[model samples]
Target: MIPSFPVDVERIDPLLASEVRRHYDRGGRTISFCSGSFLLATLGLLNQRTAITHWRYAEQFKQRFPHITYRDDSLYWYDGRIGCSAGSAAAIDLGIAVIRDDFGYEYANAVARRLVLPAHRDGGQSQFVQKPLAPVNAALAKVLDRAVKHSGSGSTVEQIAAKANMTRRTLDRHFIRHFNMTPHQWLCERKLEVARQLLETTHLSVEQIAGRAGFDNAVTLRHNFNKYLSVSPTKYRQTFKSSQQPF
Candidate 1:
């Protein structure tokens, strides 16, 4: 794992570069946090591979490594072999992903809970999210939890806001301030998380998963899965399930 470092380092020590290259050549996994991507790019490990660094360095990194596919919007990214976190906070999310991949969803979630962190955050989430000023009110939090619990019912943003006794505009403001996203986006993310958990832990069919996830249908689920994850639900299930370490 490569931690954040000065991206402006003019030259990598030859020995360190040689070691990193040797590790890659032997099919070792690689993970970089923040500007650590610079090291990976310098060695051409990121060429033609999707990568992300802190948004502050996006322009400079892209200019210097045009061959690397830089995803500015992603908070973190992983392609089985290589992984990257966009910033320090994102490093936690990526670390949890690594734990989930190595151990199992339940084990990872348990670990996250012990650390007082959210169990997961999708890798494709934007990097520009602002830190929330405070936690949501109890009513609003309860509504959000219920929405996730009954995601299959396809609750609309208006209905959810109403359940929390807030106007749509008010709810939007709260969501943006606390979650750095609109209510609809948060709802979609929650649904997607539910879908992913089911995929990882159950034998449910795609159509069934779609309904449970609050997607309009299986086709919509497939489309959203591909758009956000660059992988089909079936393929994602196979990848995670096959590689999942027994708890």
Candidate 2:
């Protein structure tokens, strides 16, 4: 069932919300798109559950429902019988996943082909979120652009700072203020994101993916994957693989 639009959670009828909660508690599956997660959350269905909403509203959702484990980076997320999608296009992705679960990969792929959408997408919000060049000074914007372009190149922080004609300290401050992360952290995240995409969509070996993702070797890639994602590269690939097809 679809929730009403303009998503004023406070206005949701208490009786209706209670009924929805009861339905889920009785083992009914629920799928929410974008701000519809608010309805499920208001019914207390999302407490301690991993879920996603439109990335633009992630912070607001978190503030309103602090108990939920909000996965801001996912296109969609599923925990047990509950599912959530980020924005409209991602709703289609979630639908395809449900189809695959009920039918099979072949049926889901057929539907995706008819819709002219990819059979599957890998990684997370990084693949869909457009990094806006905004609000920062021209120099900082240029530096950020360069960082995105060269994130998989194993570029040094000193080199990036030099490209911006800023001291390392100055670069660090700007990155912290603007990105809420250090340069090294941002670069590592970018590299790992790229590696995840490769793992899902390509037939590359772990060592090959590591080199392309700026890691020194497969060992380093595995170490960083475990540190950041709590899963080894091989395991991550296996978990997210779209079909039994090679790669």
Candidate 3:
């Protein structure tokens, strides 16, 4: 089901509310697929809860609900009461993972093979998001596109500010006004965004990811990761996302 998150919160209707109530009462897990993560999140049930969403929209998702820790690196994230999947394909992985957890590894393996994907992967939705961005700023907006394309190289705020040809203070203001974050914050988010990609797409170690993400070390990476994403660096990788979910 579609949720009004990153769109409108008041738009969630009575019918959907009733449905959610029923789901809650059923005593089963409540899981959101992709944008549907917005629903559980908006209901505030996901606050301080482990969850995930489509990696491409992770930045906007985090911006809209800072209370909820957005785990982009996970293939499928679940704290039992709530769950978030990475993207479309990760949904299948989530299904299998849940089945394995609920049923057994043998059955889960059967399901995974039936779906024709590897039984498991290293971690979160990170592999699925390649860090696509919409350039909306004026001067630095031109550089935003370049920034995302080379996100793997790790761009710094000072360096980016210079590229935008604006004073650091001006760039910081623009970042907040345009993207709802300071320039440094936005750059960190961007680095993490692509970090997920490398985690999933490449056989990189945490140290390598740290370097590519412009983080000083795994500890620093974990610090920033825990501050915003709310999940440990290792746990984020094994997470999942599913588009077939009904929310």
Candidate 4:
């Protein structure tokens, strides 16, 4: 794992490159946080691979490493063995992602909670929040909190809207204004997050997890998992379940 560093165009060190190369040759994972991508690119590890750095450095890094595919909008990215994070806080997001892959969802969530952050942001989430047209309203905030708390209860959008004393149209308007998505879309994302957590942390069967996550059934769970994540729940569990317990 390489930490952030200043981007220096004339700072190549043969010794450092040789050491990083040796690790790569040993089949170890390579990860760069923020400006460390410059070193990774300099060592040829990022050649033809998708990468990112701080948005401030995106232009310079793209010019310097034009062969690498730079995604300026991603918070972080990992393709199995090699990974890159966009900026400072984004490094933590990448680290949690690594923990999710190496350990499991429960452990990753614990680590994130300790750091006082949401469980984990997907690598593909936007690198920064887009400026909202207006500040989030108190009712909208309450609705969000309520929806999350009741996410596993199979609550309908109408039920959630009523809890905030909102009509479905009002709720949809507020959701679109604040999140740029419908209320149902936001709810589905939360459900997916809940389903993934159960898959990685529990030995529950797919049907059980589906019910816990408020999906209609195992088929619904599988459909949503595949539609949103391009993977099935069973396959996701198989890939992410950890043998060791979380700290």
lDDT of each: 0.81, 0.73, 0.66, 0.79
lDDT of 1: 0.81
Pitting candidate 2 against candidate 4, the one with the higher TM-score is 4
Task: Supply the TM-score for candidate 4.
Answer: 0.80
Candidate 3 lDDT tens digits, 1-247: 3322453453567887778868777886776777788777777677777667776777878888888776654666755455667767767766666664454334555677777876552222222222234556676777888887887676788888899998889888777666656777777777786666555445678788988887888888888777766776676555422212211
Whole-model lDDT, model 3: 0.66
What digit string (tens of lDDT, one per residue) describes model 1 on residues 69-169? 88765778876578888889888878887777665567778779887988664643222223335888999999988887887778889998889999999
What is model 1's C-alpha RMSD? 4.4
List candidate 1 stretches off by more than 4 Å. Answer: 3-9, 25-27, 33-38, 41-81, 84-92, 101-104, 113-116, 124-134, 242-246
Candidate 1 at residue 172, lDDT?
95
TM-score of each: 0.70, 0.60, 0.50, 0.80
Model 1: residue 71 alpha-carbon error in angstroms: 9.0
lDDT for each residue of candidate 2 in 109-195, tens digit (9 for 90 to 100): 779988998655322221222223237678868877877687678877888889888999998988877666688887888788678
lDDT (tens digit, per residue) of candidate 4 on 9-110: 646778887899999999999889989898888888988788888888889998888888887647778766888888778888777777776766788888
In angstroms, the error of model 1 at 137 is 4.2
Worst 10 residues of 3 by lDDT: 121-130
Off by more than 4 A, model 3: 1-22, 28-137, 240-247
Tell me how many clashing residue pairs each candidate has: 0, 0, 24, 0
Instruction: Please state every model's RMSD to the true fold in angstroms.
Output: 4.4, 6.5, 11.1, 3.6
